[model samples]
Target: MTRDRFSYLAPWWLPGGNAQTIWAARAARRHFGPAPRWQRSRWDTPDGDFIDVDEALHASAPQAPLLVLFHGLEGSSASQYAVAFADFAAAHGLAYAVPHFRGCSGEINHAPRAYHSGDFSEIDWILRRFAHENPSRPLLAVGVSLGGNALMRWAGEMEQSATQLVCAIAAVSSPLDLAAGGYAIGRGFNRVVYTRMFMGTMVPKALQKLEQHPGLFKREALLAARDLYEFDNLFTAPLHGFRDTVDYWTRASAKPVLHRIRVPALALNARNDPFVPAASLPTLQDAGPSVTLWQPAHGGHVGFPVSHGPFGLPGHVRAMPEAVGNWLLAQL
Candidate 1:
């Protein structure tokens, strides 16, 4: 697609004309709103890795579908989006689970290598365990940002497998192109805040691993790294067997995997999202009919808010989880 087309599809938000800005403003209000509390639990995988899961059940759902949620990089079950979505599913009589990745659950994994954007093995394990334990119930997945990438890729690869447990899936603000994503947040003020936020989680995880093994990771070099791309290049790339960060991004980006998704999948992307470049998103050709790509003119990153009243919270902003809930119900 041409640059002009990309701009038209994912243009910058202008005053009163930008969905991204409006979404952010509305989401900010809803995000800060009070929410219901749920019980949290930790599950151990067969490989000795631990993941935190938040579960909510409704009285109406004696045998409802399970909606497993995955959060973005450095995000956890505590993330506003994850918790809100879980609550939304519960209201709609669907069971919900949000599994916190490697160290994001407050407890670091036993292994030295931490979770990355395309860490599918843990999610695969979760699916297997859930299926084995609850064979009667159908399983679905919803992912945001990095989690979206991993979930989408896993769905594609598992399309023809014997354990085709997934019935449907959805992802929001997925950085289909990791290389572009890094570039999006690489330069300028975004780099400073986002990079630090990512490192705040990753560095400590690495340090914890270092505290465990002491010799495996080059602590000094990793500590001195400046950007996400550099940090991944030094640690994530080598640990995962790619030549470097570039190679890891090249192989791990989910754009190439969209065509293989056989199950119903909804992917939402916004033109003004800071984390994903509009040009890198998959179109009808890249994503087969099985994948429905939803793009609004404006919604910054994960923000999607609709106005409800002059002073009242926008219904769309409050209804995102409901939107997801409704989608899950449709799949049933």
Candidate 2:
């Protein structure tokens, strides 16, 4: 497994984790190029639910590789990272698709179940379908945060079989240790900031889910939820077959399954990521040889802004996607 600083430096102006993360989410939008004109397609799930996929299809060369991006929690294809990667794919002559997690798309899903950190079955279904559709093209995947963990779980779960579906996988800023990350996000600044922001959308959507499926969960308990733990216990866990938050976090974590991955996998995280405790990250010995641990000293929570962009303002953050994309291609 590869480790150490592998070419990402946070701009000197933005040194802390929150600064990089917050800027990446908020301000980096202005720096990105025009958003791609997406070719949207809806695919019905096996459970009669649906997911929307935004595709930026361009083959600079015949059968150029396709990069599939999985967005973070409460995120969609319109996320800054997704746009950045889309811009990168266009510039480099590759096909890119961002498959929205059920409910992350504009519409609410039909199922009682929603996406979770260890939703590997969802990943398996999506990627395999992509591979089946484009048999001649190589498949590459990059997952951010929650998406990353889930993607990693699918890779480990599939083991050698995963290699047949994708050329390589890069998981950016994944909370591999769900228990640690979940716990961390429930406390102090993270709880006040991130947890609150997430709940703003999550609670309402969950309520909508409850409306769709009567008695899916307790409305009072869901409303009382002040953190992810409580919300997960009330909704995510029960709907997805987990006993509770603890059970869900324990069983869904990708860290335990890392040793099973057979294809080239990159687990990239910032030591200072607020949501993922640095101590929770796996050691070199903990994973299979196919895994590469790129724990850069900086680059907070998928935020890898350079000192300047071509526009010459600070907080240019596409470097993360580009570096990972190049790394994935190198494996081929």
Candidate 3:
């Protein structure tokens, strides 16, 4: 409910919501820049699959605060936002690592199942292991889009149990209401552009998975899927043990569980976000005492383009990561 958490002003040239969101995903990669160096580690999951993590650290600060980053759907450590965040963490002397969701690490996973919006077990395993390995360092987390939804769900499920594991959490442009999000992205321009973009990669991946595990999925229905809703109903829901797309979206959404989150958490959603409708965003009252919902008038999806200086000197200033890093630093 408090509107004074952080101030974000979009760039002068980037005007509407679509422009800001599209440009960030399309044109802003080269401008925002990349991480200095990354150390890759693969962790084998108990379910016989693997999640790859790319770590970016300040060599001088061995015990600096650690941040566990979760990238969005179909996104990996190489994503523009992820790389930008890694750069920010490294420059600030914060040790950070991005854990790629199943089958998103540029390598095909072993299992037939892929990660969904609400799935958090893989992230939990990574965090628990990180906390165990580096007990001295402060732990914080940031999740983007789908990853953000999962982080919120995990925080809610863990409640006070997360206090020792993470000092605080931030969710940027998350689709907290999965049903609304799914419906929003299924219509008009979103269906033609965003849905196709997602399904383009997803269908092929599902086909590849089918090739490895014959007779495991309904190939005809999956191949016929034109949008996210159809894809979920045909593939994601069944593969994840949900009865249907409606059932999956209802249960997987982070909105229902936001009240249960016990950690100091920030959920930042752009009012103009193309994918997640502004109406779907949780209110401060719905989020309970521990969580804060900040809906800026601008900032499309994960895109928060600002003037320079925030991310060192001039050029493209990614506001979300800078805001998150500043908040985490304050919490620490």
lDDT of 3 by residue, 1-332 (tens): 25436677777778878878887776674223344577889998888888888887445376788888899989988777887787778667788888888889888888989899988776688789989987889999999999999999999888899887999999988999999989999899898889989998999999988998998778887888888888888888988989999999999888988899888898989898998998888986788788877888888878876655655223354567888788877877
Arrange candidates, best lDDT first: 2, 3, 1
Query: Candidate 2 versus the native: TM-score?
Result: 0.97
**TM-score, ranked from best to worst:** 2, 3, 1
Look at candidate 2 and tell me the lDDT of residue 1.
78
Prediction 3 TM-score vs. true: 0.94
**Model 3: per-residue Cα lDDT at residue 225:** 81
Error of 3 at 219 (Å): 1.4
The regions of model 3 sitting more than 4 angstroms off are 29-34, 308-315
lDDT minimum window of 10 residues, candidate 3:
308-317
Report the number of the highest-lDDT candidate. 2
Model 3 local distance difference test score: 0.83
What is the C-alpha lDDT profile of model 2 across 83-174, one tens digit per residue? Answer: 88888888888888999999999899898888999999999999989998888789999999999999999999999999989999999999
